[model samples]
Target chain A: MLRVKSPQDLGAGLLFIFIGCVGLYFGKDLTYGSARAMGPGFFPIWLSWIINFMGAVCLVRSVTLEGDPIATIPIRPILWVSVGVLLFGYLIEHVRLELALLTLAVVATQSRRQTDLTQKIVAGFAILFGIAIIATRVQTFAFLKPFGDAVFGVSQWICLALFAIYALLTWGERDARQTVILSVCMSIAAVTIFVVLLGQAMPTYTADYIAPVFSKIGSIFSSIRGR
Target chain B: MDFNVFSNLMTGFVAAGTFQNIGFAMLGCMVGTLIGVLPGIGPIPTLAMLLPITFGLDPLSSLIMMAGIYYGAQYGGSTTSILVNMPGESSSVVTCIDGHQMARRGRAGSALAIAALGSFFAGCVGTIFIAGFGPPLASFAQKFNSPDYFSLMVLGLVTAVILAQGSVLKAVTVIIIGLLFGLVGTDVNSGATRYTFGISSLWDGIDFLPMVIGMFGLVEIIRNLEQESIERNPISTKLRDLWPNRQELKEASPSVLRGTALGSLLGILPGGGAVLAAFAAYTVEKKVVRNPSFAFGKGAIQGVAGPEAANNAAAQTSFIPLLTLGLPSNPIMAIMMGAMMIQGIQPGSAVMTSNPDLFWGLVASMWIGNLMLVIINLPLIGMWVKLLQVPYRLLYPAIIMFCCIGVYSSNSEPSQLLIMVFFAAFGYILMRFGCEPAPMVLGFILGPLMEENLRRSMVLSRGDPMIFMQRPISATLLALTACVVLLIVLPSFRKTREVAFQE
Candidate 1:
């Protein structure tokens, strides 16, 4: 009896063999022209065979070699994280970016056991409001257009305010003061680098609302250059 | 030997020295170090996430920044390996053996300083090697015909199979699976769909960004989540004890030089780069320093210095194949090739002639980036240590958010997000089976090119299959591939290979 010493290798080998079989079956219909005049299927079918052969070799080796045993899978984290990501993908298309991000943060954080319910909920809401403010200022959400021209034309100062509130509520006093400070600095740096310096195509604010502020800054730079 | 090389490099410096380019380089170094400090987030996912952002910049600037991130991550990965005993990436795994031991003995600062200094020196040498060798290699590659290219690709794929850190059979199987996945779109010759299975998004082939994000980024998160908690050792807080003593420097200097030479040489070979170089350096250093002041694994500065130098050197020189022959020696270079194609620059010999500014500018920026990394990292050690202290619970969600946002923004298609989810599950399964993802990534990137070259060669030869063997270069390459395959198949060699990876 050939005992399977390496279950991981055995599983991988079987998977590869199955995939190769599937590839061969699917590629059957494509033309396999002569080697001199190769068709679409010529290269793929050959590769499939080679894969199948390699898989068989792996299967044989699994019976002979001793290796690390497979570890127990963490189903809870995998499920929660998968659902969280799927939800973001699903919601980003249908709902506003702010709502999608909020839902994602709440759902994804469920995977962790350390955080309290109150903190989780607070973090969720803070993410929701913070993103809404950031989106309003940064103009990332296309759906927000339906709110007319002057709907929540918050200044950049609101972004700073929302970040502070989010940081305080989410991070709390649990030795996360450094994280909070780092986050603030990173955001400021990102905004300056991506928006101010690089002049990325994404809108920083509503055209009519922030035009005067930028123009004023632009005039100051021009005057400095002229001097 | 060529004066044109020096003149071109100077031109490249002039182009790359702009304030904006330098700023981007600095930004890349900072971001790279930050992510590298974080466990489970390597350069692949970081680059995948930043792909969209780079799309907005010019090709030269984007490439320069990306290269900076790659090298900077290598530097940052060593920090965690030394201090926390947790290797942030595969290449840093060897560093942990002696590096963490040094940290436990309250010599964390010395280990970090030697690693940084060694890496900087290796990076400089590697850059100079590229500047000297890149042009002649490109010009030589320009003379290669279809059969030669096909043979070269065969050799490259074989090398990939050999270098993969597992059973050769399993690596080959994974690579084939990757090629099958690459065949999911319309065939260029017949315009017939291969494996789309009626999905509209499969019309243009699977997007590389989502696949990479799913495999490297999302899969890593799930794996990290499996652990109940990550155990982290406390780091020393003293800044004054950072520098190595005179005797320690004397011991480290020769090892660093040897490792650099080994890394630079190996980096040029197909499928041999930073990971292999680091391992080789460590193994050689073990033999070279027979009478170490301390035991081999107990706070040996040579161990820290040599591998760090080798890995950085290898990382820089790995650009040779991609820049010269349009062949990616590894997955990271494959991604770089993809980035180039996205920017409308076809990789290979033509790039040197067609876009001299882009080529030389990227090279010059690499040197600048290495300098910037040293300047940026030494002072920010405390901040990085603080970053490592952030709980996985909080850190992971932020990473996930970035991945989601990055994938979503890549094509602005909701369907791409679905693709990421599918590949994440697929990648998790692959991981469970002990199949490495690096070979698959290389296969996916090279599959189409391989097919194109094969067909072109066959057409040129008028249906003769022996054309590959008939050509001298092709025959030589095929022989080399056979030799490598034979070496792997031999039981004694296979054992040594497995033992090397196990360490």
Candidate 2:
């Protein structure tokens, strides 16, 4: 009897076979016309079969051939990062972009093992303050006020504040100084490129605030041209 | 073979040589080099992120810029492979072997110089090949019917299966899964939904940008996080030592020529591209350099030069299949195809005839981009090397955030972010099983085309199953596909295939 050599292959084969079967099930109702004119199901049915054959081959190989065994998966990082992404998706719609970003940054960084706890606690509250200030500034801008209004309601602020405290209690252990700096630089560059230079629409402070600054710059350029 | 090519090229140069086009090309090269210098970020994700930005520019300028990024990344990837022993992209994996060894032996400057020079030479020749061959090939492909196209796609998929590393069975499985993913949208023929699972967002199919970001960018972050903190002491070499000596130059010249020739030829094949070219060239160099002055692994300039040249040559010539046949041989080319479609320019034989300026201008810009890469990279080597010192913890979050923004910017849809998250987990699971995702991406891009052609050919044959056999070109392509499959399945060739990839 051939012994199973690689659990990785076995899992992968099973997954592929499962997906192929699922495809077959779903595509069952679609038309499978004759060779003269293929219906919607013709290509998919053949593809599913091919997938099943390949998966079966993989399954057979898993028992017959020697291969690399599955490594120990890091569940912690996967879970935290996934939750972080989901949280961003949830919050971006409800709480708007800036708060979503803050939440994402705090949650995602939790995946990393932190050595210093005290510094992290300090950074956590400081980051919250910075976020609040930015949120207020965004609300102050004319064009961005609506977006900011939807995000900074009383209940949302309370929820974010509570989450901030929870983050401080459970997750705020890693040094985020460098992360903060990089995020700031990235946001600035993104705004400049996508907004200023390209004239593309993006969620930022506002075009009202941006227009006067650009107009002044444009005037300087026009004056140079005149000269 | 004709002055028509010269006249067309002159038109291209006149269009592409303007200051604005040159500036965009330079910008692309600079950004591409930065992306390549950073580990864990490859060309696919970078291109996907840049796709949105292309909307604002004219098609020709955007294409010129994106093309610059493609080859420029190849050049920068080699630098990282040589300096840090970390390949910034898959195509640079072969470079880490002897290139890093050379760096360790205090020959970093010579290795870097030869890599740059060999790549530049190969790029020039590759561009010339495009200028000479692209038009005729397009004309030839324009004559192909549906059966021929279907057979060619089949050949392309088979080649992808063969060229992919690891188990052949797994590669095929991944490709099949990719095809199924492609089937998730509405069926054009019967107007029936295949596998939307009642999700409205999935009705139009999974967005390519989100999938690519999740698969390559987010999955890489997760994988990097799984590792112990990345702490490596990069080799410190002086800028003055960047020049290769006369003896080294003499040794690398023949290898560069050989690699250029090999890569240029291989790159035209359906599944062959820079990664395969680099791997094949290195193997050839190992065999051809009968008496090596230095050990192959320790510090051989030939090893660096040959693969470097081959990869750059492959990067350039890989455009031929996409430009002429409207077929992408690899994932990078597939992403390029996506960029073209986004610009409302359909890629294929018609591209040359309908948009000759765009075609020739992109070709001409490749040479300028190559020139800019050498000029930009050599002086900026120190900056890139310094960039390598940034902590992975800081870098990962930035990458993720950038990906999030890039995806959101593409369609301004929150659901796309969720789609990205889904694929991120899915990609991670697949990676754990040792399945390469590149083949899957290629399959996803080619799936609809394959189906369209298959159905069209069948309809033309009036239910005759023997249509593929009746068409000479289709029959030949099918025969070639069979040979490839046989070569993979046969025990002796399978071992050689494994050895080639493992090397």
Candidate 3:
């Protein structure tokens, strides 16, 4: 039977109240000792009560005063972005950093679809790979390097990513053939950065069955170079 | 004893002047400028995003980098405002007014120069102010008992509520809720965990990185993405003649001086101090300047200089309360406090005596960082302006990728990502309800400390409530708090505050 003049205020009031109740309910079990011998619950309980009182005041104000209406919230952006982030998060340790990054960009683009889908896909994957390479320090092929195990510098990996980003981004007005070429260039740069620089232990890719084959291939190449 | 400031600074310079620290400081500045020039990102998210990178750094080096980022971001924000009329940071919003107008009227060079020079002068003065005042304040803080500390926090929280943007009541509730959130995790006194929901990660309390990145970083990206077309068309600025003319300089100097003085004082207060300082300086300049080459909004150099100086000065001095009293006056300082805690160092008066090198080194690095901003950013304005053309569609995904890697790499646990998702959703909901999540962070940081001090005070008083009134420091702080509360409730002050924000 209560009329809400300001939906924003009303919603905020309800949220504050709910938050207070959660605090109170969860903290109920802890002993609320006297002030002189205060227990864990003492301060929290006091704070929760104050929050509840504030919420009640907000509720009264919501009905009594004129205020702003709640603005319409766009759900697509938040949903797609969140989905993309979560996908990257869960996929990083399993699928590897590169694929996870690619998945994130692909998912995020779904929030606002455009006719330049091919370009979007290319730029998104390119820039994201650049960021991923920077985020987790690139691997140094310390064990397999031809420099008698002496590795190159770490800065080159970042430069590789940076170059890939600039190359693909500037070619946005071009056709898909160029996009593919740029993408290939970026991938080669990424692999070289990971393999040729001071290595980090970050997993770039991981598949249970294919892991043995890659390591086997690496061992064979190292053995061939050792002679 | 007063002469010790020089020796202290000498030590600070020696410690922070190392090539390693300088390199980190410059790196932080460059990264910070890149983040700040990009619209839709603020210092809070940028700081949260870059926090993981500093994990491998020495405490002093990390703090230096963080401070560099803070100042560089603020400076970069001003540049964006001058060049594009899009205020990249909140404190630079007023700058966009006359600053962009100056650009439109072909005095963009003058505007940028005045702002940069004014900010440089302000930053130097602020650093000196900290050097002069920090020790005295810390020494005085040493005299504070548990009750005094408790009262000080109460005063801080009250003032923060008053100074925060939007409704007074709502802000109060938000802070209270934050305090409650801070109470989650294990209680130091009792060794019992509260509100963890049986999760192992909750035993250590909520992780700061996930909460911050989720709330500020992720939410920001989502908000930016919501706009139909995130196209940015920056005004083409000619940076060839970057010096201000004699007349423009002469006009802006006095206003800059006034702004620096006003800001240094206001910055010591709690909550949104820099933002308020900028806003207040604009009002002061309007009243003080007798005439202008153009109208106030029509490219007045005084309008551009005063607020820019004030905000930079405020940003520097806002560290006073956090450094001396171990209280975070704003959310930004709260993050600093969190960083210090993560580094296993507690911020307080003791830091001056116990970790003199780190304290003075940090203070010295601030000056170096400011110098770096002026030197590095002036030449790089063209590069930053070009960055404005990078489409937002490409930017957001990169930002998200960076955030996820930072968060995951920091803890390397899957649950941390889940925590981020939770905070992002919570922040999004709060945004819809017109409730800010910023003040909550301040409260959360203070929560456990306040409880510990409060409980100790109660014990010292033998359960008597009047002990707070008996102590001089406590009583004075309480009195100040009462005055602030009265100011908030008063109709006249409220009207003025409303008018101030309206401009």
Candidate 4:
């Protein structure tokens, strides 16, 4: 490892010098301009020579430096991630986006939490079933559009419950409740700001639909108290 | 040239000074910060997402908000780079070297403060330069012909290659690959498809959103998952004491100055963007700094300060080439040019003659935006520092979800997601193999522009090729290019290589 610097420097510098010279040589096909004016081939041709000179300087410097000759760090994880990303380019189209993404996340992740057989099965089913339900039955949230294109009013208690359950079950963790809370609050805030405060005309929603949903939520709480 | 332009601009500010514009600027800043804080999404996509909303506002207000987002995003980019080792864009890569290290060593607060302060200073300088020098610069640019632009673009491409780390062959190859990828959309002259491979959707070429998010963001997510939790170094709770000491400040001040100058200059070049400015600044600092113990890669303070300032300065100055010459140096500026057209204001020399208020209003608004940024970032440094302490397990999912949502919202196509994922995997591999993704990114950006200019120059010269050197500006640029080549080529010129190789 200690002797690596000299070789690396020399190697990089020599390579640059070589390439720069190639550029310079090719630049000969270009016309040289006076210091005041340039010709057609002037820039590329001259730039090549400059690159070659810099590379030579770098190569010479490497000779005198004391560098380690061994690999600096393990490279396996990096390789895995890079490969995973490329695979995703092919995977997302054939498979649903949610599934492809979850799979990618699980494969690359190295978590400290322990999972038994039942947990793994349950987790897998949880991810799959959760996405399926949201994609098919959930009407309030329009995430996977072309598949589940529906407009429901707040009268649908089932949709509201589903959203709550999904949020709690998925994001709810014991150690970090703050993140979950923040996500929930922030998501709601964002929706309110975008949809209600900013008055961005929803492609689907109208004033009548929103007005009733709030009233329904209020009524649900009031009814539980025997109002 | 018009002294009363300031007063006229102040009149436009009646539109700009309204509560609505203020709200938009603040909103833009907050949103820009969030987007910039993320490791992969830069301002370009963020602006694109907000593009539809701008249609409702007056042009002055909309432009102000977008400008706020531009500068705010620059500040936000530094946050993730410093806090985590994740860089939101190629420019922030330099910041990661020192910034993440500072976090590890418990000086994350100082790094954030210095980056914010340096950016504010540069932003102020840049705003003033724009207001004072914009008209003059515009006129100077009018002198350029296709040959001049061609030569300038060549300089930019070469400079990008020279400043990039790693093997020159690899850099060049990646650059060429990017160029080729950019050419995939359509043939302008012949109206023929070159490399679409018969995919009809791809006939328009690869969408920038999916490509950028996949290559940088998703790939990063994959890499993050592979590693053990990023809790290797916990941030300090007592962040109030994190300000740089006098000595550290003294060391870093000059770097900030140098970076500002370098950024200001490079930002004017065609195809030169924040990333290039940052890299060039870092390289310059690396070369000029004396007795630097840590190598360029190992947590150098100048690495953080220089690049941060450079990016901010470059962000402001990039507007120069775009507004003056009507040349879009980057995708973001191209979008801005588009926005201008939507407003019925054409970008070119005539804009200066016709719309002095619009021009000066923008320049004045930049100064105001810089002031707002400094006020917002300084007190919020501790809050940003605390954000760094969030656990990876809790954080990674949200990051992935955001990437998914951001990508999906852009095109509403499932294919884009697939493209992003593929690029993520490919990007991860390249990272593992020690490939610098900066070259690939730069290649992708410059390739199309380079081809266009080359063709333009060729057509103008009737394929003679001598037209490039016929002009003074082009000739000078070519000479410098030659000198650069000679410097790289001459083996005997490497006598002082030892100093350069010092750790």
* Candidate number achieving the greatest TM-score relative to the actual structure: 2
lDDT of each: 0.79, 0.80, 0.80, 0.61
C-alpha-based local distance difference test score of model 4: 0.61
DockQ top scorer? 2
**Model 2 vs truth, CA RMSD:** 5.5
TM-score between candidate 3 and the true structure: 0.87
Candidate 3: segments with Cα more than 4 A from true spot: A114-201, A205-227, B1-3
Each candidate's DockQ score against the native complex?
Answer: 0.39, 0.53, 0.36, 0.09
Model 4: chain B TM-score relative to the native chain B:
0.75
Candidate 4 — which residues are off by over 4 angstroms? A1-227, B1-16, B35-66, B77-115, B232-263, B266-311, B325-362, B439-449, B471-473, B487-503
Tell me the docking grade of candidate 2: medium
Task: Report the lDDT tens digits of candidate 2 across residue range A5-33.
Answer: 98888988888888889888998998988
Clashing pairs for model 2 are A36-B463
Listed per prediction, chain B TM-scores read 0.97, 0.97, 0.98, 0.75
Which CAPRI quality tier does the interface of model 1 achieve?
acceptable
- How does model 1 fare in lDDT? 0.79
Task: Name the lDDT value of residue B139 in candidate 2.
Answer: 86
Candidate 2 lDDT tens digits, B412-486: 776788798888888888888988887788788778888998888888988786999999989999999999999
Looking at model 1, residue B2 earns an lDDT score of 41
